[model samples]
Target: MTPPPGPPPLPELHWLEQLIERGHPHLQAREMRRIHVPGGPSFPVHAITLGNPDPALPAVGYFGGVHGLERIGAEVVIAFLQNIVTRLAWDTGLHRLLEQVRLVFMPIVNPGGMWAATRANPRGVDLMRNAPIDARERVPYLLGGQRLSAGLPWYRGRLGDPLEAESQALCELVQAELLGRPFSIALDCHSGFGISDRLWFPFAHTREPMPHLAEVQVLKTLFDQSHSHHPYIIEPQSAQYLAHGDLWDHLYLQACENTGRTFLPLTLEMGSWLWVKKNPRQLFSRKGIFNPQIGHRQQRVLRRHLALLDFLARAASSHERWRPPSDDRAQHHAQALAQWFPT
Candidate 1:
């Protein structure tokens, strides 16, 4: 019998296809949706799953490349998957860890944009800003999100329309895979801004603290204690700026409907300014600003975030042990307010 067709021609997708081919039997990859670009061949948005499939098990959803220019974001997630797939051969410990966790990866979420070298998808919509939710407060002219023109950045798409195909695909995946469980964590990676790495939580549409602020505090505490010298600035997305139609914000708000479910969505905004500062020539290249052009720097960036990704997986697995106790929830809440909502 003949084998299925290979991934479409693209470096990131090609690498992912290779991993899927190599890691077969140990992992499963499905094309969530096929994205077609104008005057170009279609590309598949694949979702790779590993570990337990039990609804009772906690899950972690790792997403990247929501913006096509942020190739580094997709690379980081791909690197982590490569590490896990290779280790599954000999890492008995990881095998045990998988028994209690469900891992979902959608490494290249916006392939059309990546192919065209634009931040927006082929339809010109920004997937990250393509959700249905609107900002409670006034957002910046165009950066926050706009319906003015798809030609402008951060386009949210026309009002009263269904979500863009990519946005709908992501929401469907999260709802089916992550929201049904008792607890789940999502880490969506992106770059192309700032000078320092940042870990942001929800409420990108508002400045108000999320319902799970206390739980966020506990996770932050665990991360700090375990990786004492970690160089991430953990805070709410609103701390930097509020935006309209953040997909995570939409999913997070939806997750709140199930009072028993705990869904903590995080955005890893890796600062690209550091890369540009080290090599100013990147300023002129569209992709260079969002991705590490230097081979060594790309490797270093991948190495730096692998631990954090692994930490989230372990944290989700052992959540019963480290998640804040009922007796301490109030204290954690108070502390969270003081730390992230300082007056």
Candidate 2:
């Protein structure tokens, strides 16, 4: 005998909806798109926003789940959102901070992929590699991105097609909320990297440094100064490997079109291998390889990153106070080069 079929179980989306309702009249949630899987249930791409609406105010976007199999990414973002929402009723300092900065969130960018337990979306395209940009230098074969088949890992959508819905939604949200501001930051979280965590900035599509390397160095310095024992390795994505169609590189380039604006995009690639090392049995599950499957371990992961997210919010709110003046900009730039691109 066979069991009856059931609707796809997406607790994250459900929880997100409940969260929006709980945050009624405060945070606004918009459906970016409706993702319809051929045989499975459809999912809504939600973008939640709160804080100042003025373009003059700086903003920070917190994103996750660009690769669906990495549920921990989405969970970390939602945990931070939850932290903010729950504090809204009583945290006067938070309310003041919100008045000065904008916060955008798309905690589950690829819910369809999460439903199917795949790295690629339901269409088999990797959302992270679906942007139109190509690597300026040679990239690792296949892993960098490929058009061979959707059946393969790291499959970019077919050439000449429009960006994937998830990718488009994210790009649109960033352009509308984060770009054009005097200063903005983006943090897209993911897992399944090496034994150590990493904070990667732009130019994943090329070996060349981004125009804002000096600002990146400042941000890294501030973070290090505040959390001396923080468990993150901050550097350019190029420091690891280059890839084609990297969405951040494409978006960062678009942001640079405005000389007056500063957009510092960062990706938090969590070190899932540490979890797998402690509990080697997690290797048997594809999702487990990218998430902390144990109850307490997952809680710890969420707790630790909350501080980083909060710091970004506070940093965006006060970017003017810290960004270098013209007199010191070159000095900062030289310092950044020596540290990251030592001769």
| Worst 10-residue lDDT window, candidate 2 | 1-10
Structure candidate 2, residue pairs in collision: none
Worst window of 10 by summed lDDT in candidate 1: 2-11
TM-score of each: 0.97, 0.97
**What alpha-carbon RMSD in Å does predicted model 2 have with respect to the real structure?**
2.5
Q: Please identify model 1 stretches exceeding 4 Å from their true place.
A: 1-8
lDDT of 1 by residue, 111-140 (tens): 888888889989999998888888999888
- Residue by residue across 175-287, what tens digits does model 2's lDDT show? 99999788999999999889899999988997777889888888888999999999999988989888988899899999999999999999999999999999999989767
